[model samples]
Target: MNTLQHGFQLNYGNTDVMLLFEGQPDHLVPCTSQILLDSDLFLVAGRMVGHSFLHGGPALAGISEAVVDVLFGASPDMTTITVEDCPDLERRQTIQLLDGNKDLSEEEKDAVWKLADMWDLPGVTSDNRKWLFSRLLQHAVLGRTDKQIKQFRRGLKETCIWQLLTERKDVIPLMFPRERDVEIKPQMVLDQILWPLETTNEDEDYPVETRCRIAGYLREFIATASQSSLRGLVQFWTGWEVPSSDMQLEIVQGSLPKASTCFKSLRLPGHYTNFKDFSQDLNACVATCDTGFGLV
Candidate 1:
């Protein structure tokens, strides 16, 4: 907003019209309208008319000179001309002009469409413009099941969601699977069980904390899958501390179908007091699945 102030007032009536000279264009002096009057710099407005002689000046090249000349020529003198120039006007004008032109090929229009979308402009209105941009930026990174990812994608912009599925670039190498990893199968088993907990319908009613717990458990299970060994994965989640022996025994005693043979075989050295206690412990283990010993 800070700009040069005018230095003096000039009379448009007293100014003489001069013929536009073409040679040495760059050095050609700016139009009198370009000169600031009264305070510091030039002003363009209705007062300065018929000065098309200034049109060919090099200073006007690469500018909105044509538009400015057309709009302010008749009133240039009284126009409150500030000295600051808009640097992005030319590029913006080019984009606007490209969108306005209908003669471009479909392919060329697609490119322009992407540019407009990237710049967050309204000009790109092709039926699949938003979808196309999303696919182009897609990267598959997460190793989550397609269903889990579908949920994640639902929360993201349509244009960015496909990358997680199509590209598989979301999975970090450190977390990528390796051969002979028994933990992978077990983690898959855990995920298969936990995935059902994540199901939610738009019309279904549930407490906010329950939803958060489901999401947190799923994310934790996915994170733990990246570890190399069962002990390592369990340790990563359990923080290497042993779970309570009585709680482990109680988990073992629970006749619930949800409890796995693996949970029984690990011979967890603890007793859980009751079914409620066991269920709470199971949820806590998965909830704190990333924490040490699953105590949390």
Candidate 2:
């Protein structure tokens, strides 16, 4: 008989072996030496389950679920293995291993989710859950048929993930299109349409019809937006000096055609001159208006 490092005796066949319980310092358990020699059993040194047999002492901490099932025969009550039982192991490795397998199944994904939930793993946590949700949403959106997109959208609405769509700032355009009959706030729609127009390169390769549609959308939105929002938008895009409420209204009314004409002209080549003219017209309007305020 040879004693293993953790005070478990290794013996073959019918030989007697002694096992020490680190939790019970003074007690020893007797076992057939065949248990040590079982092909399915693997002994790992660390803490066992939730408790250490001996503080800072080598203990049998890691055991495969298969090994436990085989050792216990027909009944295995252990449902979970925690970090304390396998201090050297990381749950991410198991998830990654599962993810890498080309033949992954739904059951395997569920198992991964279960393990992540048990371990409180990062990939499945609240903060990172959006990554998974967005990928699924993207897959659905890019599906070949309108029926597929509509089906996926309907399915999503029935799940908790639908609530997350509203909370995601980066994916609003993907989830809600102006052409779609979905119910979305007007302000959100306006912001989405305006962002690319304001931020993108003027020479960028966006389709002219798209630009005209955005312009038309903006024109309609301005007609309905509160006077304060109109005033704010004018100051934001034109860098005009602040105007009194009456003058602000007048500026908004006068600028509507300039905005519309600029967007419509985008459909033609060399339309850059139209934008230049629009800017000059705006400056002339502002200067003429400023004279009435005695501030020119």
Candidate 3:
């Protein structure tokens, strides 16, 4: 899914045309490309989004809400189209000029005129600029790309999620989450950790002080880690791109931090004398996982 997001940001075949999505990275809309459409890229992208949703993978974040509204079969009027939705900078700026009180010079108006002609819209007069702007915004963001949106919907239905999506409109935010839509906090990861009571300092049968210290270091690292670091830590701990319900973390007396992906358990060395050592070793452990390991 991460790779998919990166690929979605790129142009197709040096054409400056979008393959699956358009606009800025944070406000992407589906792109209409006949070549890609013939190859079923939109359908496959939608199916991947559905599959990721069903299998505890990352949400397809950064898609514009207006586009999402359209994706889920909402009327074009139901969405609020803005200049930001227009992918072309020159066109977006032109659309913005339509709203300003300053009259556009002939040069400024030329691009808008061409776009209007291309879309079969009437030439803009003071009285009609607003209407023309609305139509141009619609055509740029929605009208020209309606077919791609349809294929996206059809692809999602192929994954058997169309009914669920249509029936529950509220979960739309979760389906294509914005960064603000889902914030992963330190306490959230802490809460998910499955700790062994025996490793606590309160346990009398064993000298568990090292485990307690290492666990404190773990908490501090998690609390101070950046969002990307935290995400990678979670993935390393659980083999899940996103957080899961059962994250079993342990502190053993010897060795670098290790993990059992199948069990969603992360084992850290209890011998760490300081937070720096613990954090460094833990980061090293998370940074690499070329092979698998397990506890006997």
For TM-score, the strongest prediction is 3
lDDT of each residue in 1-296, candidate 3, tens digit only: 65456554445558542446767856787766687778888889889999999887788888877888888878997688878888878778877878766889997788788888988988888899888888889888999888888888888899998888889988778889885656678998999898656544643323566566677888899999988778768867877557788788776656788778788988887677888888887777776642332232
TM for candidate 1 is: 0.19
Model 2 lDDT tens row, 146-184: 232233234444444444545654443332222222223
Could you tell me the lDDT of residue 290 within candidate 3?
Answer: 26
Better of 1 and 3 by lDDT: 3
lDDT of 2 at 210: 49
Worst 10 residues of 1 by lDDT: 137-146
Q: If scored against the real structure, what TM-score would every candidate get? A: 0.19, 0.15, 0.82
Worst 10 residues of 2 by lDDT: 21-30
Compared to the true structure, candidate 2 yields what TM-score? 0.15
What root-mean-square deviation over C-alphas does model 3 reach?
A: 4.3
Candidate 2: lDDT over CA atoms?
0.32
Which TM-score value belongs to model 3? 0.82
| Residue-wise C-alpha lDDT for candidate 1, range 160-245, written one tens digit per residue | 32344345443311111121222244434344332223454554344434444544443453444434333333332323312212
